[model samples]
Target: LIKITYPGLLLEEILSTIAGNCLLCVTKLDFSAPKSLE
Candidate 1:
């Protein structure tokens, strides 16, 4: 059971990290780009 669970937990951790990085990148892009309406 431990062997099966370890990989799943690791995958979840990696996916979360990737998602967090993507969100951070998107936020940075939004901040760097100027809006025409502004």
Candidate 2:
């Protein structure tokens, strides 16, 4: 059971990291975009 579960947990961690990075990038873009447009 431990072996089977380990890969799923690792995959979740990787996915969460990627999602967090994407959110950070999007937030940065949202913050900067209007200033550039104006």
**Which candidate has the highest TM-score of all?**
2
- As for model 1, its CA RMSD to the true structure in angstroms is 3.8
**How good is model 1 by TM-score?**
0.73
lDDT of 1 at 8: 86
Cα lDDT over the full model 1: 0.85
- Candidate 2 residue lDDT tens string, 1-38: 86476988878888999999999999999989999999
In candidate 1, clashing pairs total 0
Local distance difference test scores for all models: 0.85, 0.91
| Over 4 Å off, model 1 | 1-5, 35-38
Number of the top candidate by lDDT? 2
Which parts of model 2 have CA positions greater than 4 angstroms off? Answer: 1-5
User: What global local distance difference test value does model 2 have?
Assistant: 0.91
